[model samples]
Target: MDEPARRGRLPLPHRGIAFGGDYNPEQWPRETWAQDARLMREAGVDLVAVNVFGWAEIERSPGVYSFEELDSVMDLLHEHGIAVNLGTGTSTPPPWLTTAHPEVLPVTREGETVSPGGRQAWCPSSPVVREHALRLVRATAERYGDHPALALWHVSNELGCHNALCYCDESASAFRRWLERRYGTADALNAAWGTSFWSQRYGSFDEVLPPRLTASAENPTQLLDFRRFSSDELLEWYRAEAQVLRASTTTPVTTNFMVTAHIDTQDYWSWAPDMDVVANDHYLDHRLDDPWAELAFAADATRGLAGGAPWMLMEASHGAVNWQPRNLAKAPGELERMVLTHVARGADAVCFFQWRASRAGAERFHSALLPHAGTDSEQWRATLRLGALLDALDEVVGTRPTSDVAVVFDWQAWWAVDAGGHPTQDVRYLDEVHAMHAALRRAGVGVDVVSPDTDLSGYRLVVVPTLYLVSDEAARSVERFVVGGGHLLVTYFSGIVDENDHVRLGGYPGAFREVLGARSDEFFPLDDGESVALDDGGVGRVWTERLEPRGATVRARFTDGPVAGGAAVTRHEHGRGAAWYVATRLGTGGRDALVTDVLEGAGVRPVLPGAGGDVDVVRRDGDAGSYLFVVNHGDDAFVARAPGVDLVTGRRADAHEVPAGGVAVVREQPTGRRRPSEEAPA
Candidate 1:
């Protein structure tokens, strides 16, 4: 409920869209540093992130430090006129520190200590690690605070990327302290965690422990609280380092957030306020059925974390990433398309994981701006082309993306909904969320993925997908939005539990049952690879429920299932607006149809009214003027009906033809007039 501490924005120098990536000169010889800077300038790069993993290099042992190499690198970069996004070099601990204090190592849920070969092996709750890491941060900030090349302060590489949750004794002690702060008394904690359920009551905070490996399912509420505590612990570590940096430098500070689909550790909605400027590292995971859709979802979610302000694509790959099961390289023009997609959503800077390919390391195969083949390679040429593209679109720097629809996504709910005690393993939190987002994208609409606590008045349509754990305040907010003449669509398994993971006793979806004018007494979870038929010629899968509609109209019913002839979908005209509920997991076509109907009722239209599903469109407005970004992902070329100068091609066109796997940025004419396009519809 309290206001979070605010830091200033990123202090960019000679700002256009800051174009560069992670540059590690420490990995190469002394002579290669000059060549890296030369090639950086040649590619129109004005910013480079350095020393992301420099702790081992800077502090070889306790009370001893080295800075000659870092100093020369900084001076060389400054001489080249390229600004530096300096890292505090505390992402990982050195061999000496871990060797001396092995107690700081993180422990697994099964009581196994994680060794220190990999990065981020230190426990987040360990005071020894914090003491050592902050010492490095203070030294780095004091050394480079006044450096002319320093443009921004990067806190750490990626917090919680590896060591999010630690079940060690230190973590248990920190968890107990955090619980005491949250609940004030043991009795209150017991009531909130429902300790009476399994004789898990605690008389004092010291009696509590982390949710370790158990015979059966652990206490669901305890598990949920552990996640919250783990996230807060990491955040506290970040704040400690940030405080050290602020004491020395006025430079804006931030850490790259891993906001991709796979990571669900830290609650970024709570972490967003601590940032001077929100930045994220995203990679295209080839394993997903729709990797492009996932990329769009991540970018939109990052924009949401920024509260619609422009953000930075801090670390994307130039081509392939080494982490996935099958590392597939980017196709021709795919990299450019992906970069422009982020820009369209609200990114002012485009950066990658590393500047040059490493000859030795775990990530040697990972793509880079300058590959092993040097400047003659296709990846290098594409990188040069991307730099040129970013140069021409300099006017779009601070513009923000606007959206009329929002998808409610909560990290607590994500943690609770999947915490091992649910009715069925078939229903997943992200699957429903991503399905909703993908459907909206296919409808050619721009969506903002926001938390439940975000203001819903700005959006015309708010979709809540599988938000199983919601607080009373958040539920009331959704109700107020609907009563204030806003449209709402809620999927199954949502509003079933409160903030403390306590079930709402009266009905299945107790929070919004009154607003939906429907109540289900029981749930009918389908078997694996099972589906039921809907009366409207649609199919339902995964879940179904026995519904009793009171003061609501049944729009669709299940034809054949355990809850046959039950209300599959219902709509209620609750104040000046309507609330729709889906009691069953609908198929793609069914879900799309329902979403289309809801959008039609809400009077929400897409940015490009007639654009195809493969063509994504986003509009950003600022002092520079309104810019429409059209990215075509389909096989055939698509004609975007916007009359203005194409920033990418530098030619004025009545209507821009965006080739397949290409992007088009149109600075619209002031008159807001569009020339008729003779081409057929895409």
Candidate 2:
């Protein structure tokens, strides 16, 4: 449990599945505030995040604070029976502060200073930025600490959304200080970074610098450490602000984590422990091959960060977002399906980016609960419908979803595996992770995405994908998990490097070679659009390896390619459980087949065994009973065989018909047997 949770400062202390979004009254006229509050009540909104980017509006000049408008906004929200998730308004620095202390501006890798026109333009490691931001936090907390509307203290908008990495002189100095604390001595830092390579050894921590723009690929360890340092610097800044908030009020404090597909700078596993309640901002990126699958993966990952506790869906889009190339609006019923999906995955609160659309700003076209078209619009209607559904399923407030399968996700591995100098750039960290997760989803299995260091004793099956970097302790824990009766499926390019970005030197996949009962000496990265045939009639792409199994039995072999007749996939019985290894990127069919086989061996079944791949079924258990959420993301409806009262429709039936691109929540009865199947309409 986090500090606030331990101190009984539970987030949303008196709410049931809170519903609302970022409400920026500052952006509207004072006359519109009352109307907004009225509409909020009509929409069933009980919570609103206020002043996310109000640093400049609150603190016009240095230390000169104004809370009259904010005071009115809070009072209005309280009067309307809505709670406030108050932001410290330090997301962006005022133009005056940036102009006066231009040194606090973040410098890019190319030595270009990020201008103050955008949010989060200040360097996280700069003392000037930290001091001013904390002052703002203190002042905000002091004024509104005892306010009735203050339910939670939102630290900064998104901690490292824009300025995660800064290459300025102040950042360099801070990085050295962080290094001294991490490695203790320059000699240790030299050894860990392998600074002897290419005559780049550092004599002291002072000589170390952030991995700046280099001619060729910079030192991989240096790049890895710089990424680590950058994440830590931002986390330190969050801690500083959170400390100020904690001193003022008993309200729980948290910041929205960017746990989406694109943003990867912050190591959220490290940041999760500091938050009172884990909240994530997930925006679907349509650019991916499988955006919905990625959404499921991200939600599972966020639940893992929350330690299986119910979390908050801090920011999502009602329809469309301004960012992303060719921003597209959500199809009819997509908003409800997406929101219910998050709720089913254990998000107690469902909120969007903003309550009202921005008429003029960088994200002017971004979707909101109340779009420019207002209440008559499809977006607003859908928002109101979702709010009602949330209110109906209020029984799911403190419940958690359970999953028997676990996927190991490490940000350090993500940083190191995707760094320069890898054999094939095609082996992306999330690609393999998402592919594995999608395969499981297709098999109708629930998944929990956890860090490499997480406990694996409770899981029946554990999947590791492209984990190129891992510490010895984490590797040993995984080994223990396999040896002590936990099924494991490891994919290509995993277990290659140590924590210091150094290869284990004996063989490829050096960390788990013994446990996997396999050894690989070489890699054969295929060309673009290249695929190799497997002996079992499955196709592999992007990567292939020369493998020799010692104790493991070959399940499939490469029939053609540079490494013909080699083991394409192998399985070994090591102690109490079995370990499977895939030496190449298997296509969807092959990966799904392999995953199904592993789940069968481990005796792990999906929430609804025979449900179609497009139908997602998840169950949450609470005092109210088990709530089975069936989401059909296909063109046809799905009939789920479970006896319960449908929360959405208020009907009690043995089987619920989840419509196409729709959702159904069933509060299950205790006396019915569930026959998991997807029966099409006659």
Candidate 3:
């Protein structure tokens, strides 16, 4: 168990599953508050997040505060037995404050001042903005310190969602200070940033600035460091507010983290430690042809971010989100399936972006638990149905799930691999990461998308999917994990760069070359719709490499490409375990074949063997017992072969039978009592 779990659980005042979302009573009239609360109770909601974007309503002017409106909402929720995840309301500053001090606003890279119409316009590095935000946080903590309804202290909503990279003078000064602290001297900074080229050497820290428009593209190292500094600056603001809130009350502090690959500004790996409860806000990609797969991948990634402990799905959509390019409502049963997916992975609490829909605002069209169509709508009914389902799955709380396979997804790699000047602009980090994760899901193999720094003691197989930035520490960790008898799969474009975005000299696959038992001479980036034949009757595309195996057995070789007859894949025995290197992007069939061979070699089996065709299965172990969550995402019926009582139906079945778009939660027998043949049915 993690420290948080070992100590105690959070989202307090209620046990079981937490089922409510952001409640903006400020948007509705005084009379509507009671109706919302009553409806929340009817829907089995025990928690409601409040005061998130209420800075304008709470504090009118400098140091002038009014909590009359907020007090009424809190009292009403308390009267209705709903706990509150009290927010500090520091996401956006009031219009009066912005008008009084325009310096508080951020400046873009083009040096344009941000206006006050949007949320998160204030610069995190600005002293004035920090001071005002801290003031509001202090006031909020003081008012709700001992309130009956206060459950958790939500520190500033989504810290760097908008102003992650501000090029304002205030940010520039802060960045310089951060660089000075990181590098200690200008000469050190110059050397780290490779400033000798293009006559960019800095004589003093003040000479450095946030990466902005130059005559040409900015220096890659400088841009990388600037992003690091900006992320830290925002983190510093979160820590400051969190410190004040902690001093005022014993409530747990958390800020919603955007845990997706698209938002790369803030590295949540570094920020995850500061939060008492790891809370994430995930939105389905409407652009994706298969969003549920992405959701499953994201939930597993979020669970890994929480150190395999239970986390909170702080914000998700009940139906269509307003920000996607093409907003589409959830198909019948998608809402339930989405929520259940998170819970099956490791979410102890499930909450949405809002409870009631907005009438007039930027997010007025955003779907909520209570839509604009009123309580009679399908959305509201779905919310009620989900709430009842959660009420029955109370035994799932505090449980931890273990995965035999892990996909290494590092932020450093995500930042550095996609850095400008790569061999091909088509080098997408998430594409490769998701390919491995999606394959695992399709095969019914439970997978965990974890950071490179995470401990690999639990997993039997670790797949490094195009991790470009392999720090010496991370490299050694992987080596140790493999040497300790763990199976590892490394892909192309990996282990090429160091933490500073500097390529490791000597050969490609830098620090990992020794363990991988292979080295690359050059990159053969194929053109669009082009492919290379492999010796194993498979084809590789997008990228290929001139590989020479060293003290390893060649698994496959290129047949007809620039690197013809070269090693396309190699497997090497390193100590007690094995390391496999994939030198190119193998087609889907090739990847599936390769993954299946690796799983067989590693003695790993899927949660549901041969329960194919979009039937996703995962298991979680807890004090209650083991739980097998089998969900069918296909159009056909699936008969789960796992043996246990179906918790959703509260009945013992010989085999759980679920129809199309159905779910089954089975409580299995204890591990020791189970027969050997019944161990994760093969």
lDDT of 1 by residue, 461-542 (tens): 8999998999999999999999998899999999999999999999878899989999999999999988999999889999
What are the runs in model 3 whose C-alpha is more than 4 Å off?
1-8, 671-682
lDDT for predicted candidate 2 compared with the true structure: 0.88
The per-residue C-alpha lDDT of model 3 at residue 496 equals: 91
Better structure of 1 and 3 per lDDT: 1
Quick one: ranking by lDDT, best first? 1, 2, 3
TM-score of 3: 0.97
Which residue pairs show backbone clashes in model 2? none
Residue 193, model 1: lDDT of: 93
Model 2 agreement with the true structure over 1-682: per-residue lDDT tens digits: 3454532213784468889999988888999999999999999999999998898899999999999999999999999999999999989999999999999999999999899897888999989888888888889999999999999889888888899999999999999998999999999999998988999998988898898898887999889999999999989988999899889788888899998889899999999989888899998889999889999999999999988887889999988888889899999888888998898898988888899998988999999999999999878888888888889988778767877789999989999988868898888888999999989988887788999999999888899999989889988998899899888999999999999999998887789898899999999999889999998889999999999998999999999998999999999999898899999999999998898898888878778756748998888866546888888999998998888899999999999888899889998897443322121111
Cα lDDT computed for each candidate against the true fold: 0.89, 0.88, 0.86
Clashing residue pair totals per candidate (backbone < 3 A): 0, 0, 0
Model 3 Cα lDDT, one tens digit per residue, 208-234: 888887779789998888888888998
Model 2 TM: 0.97
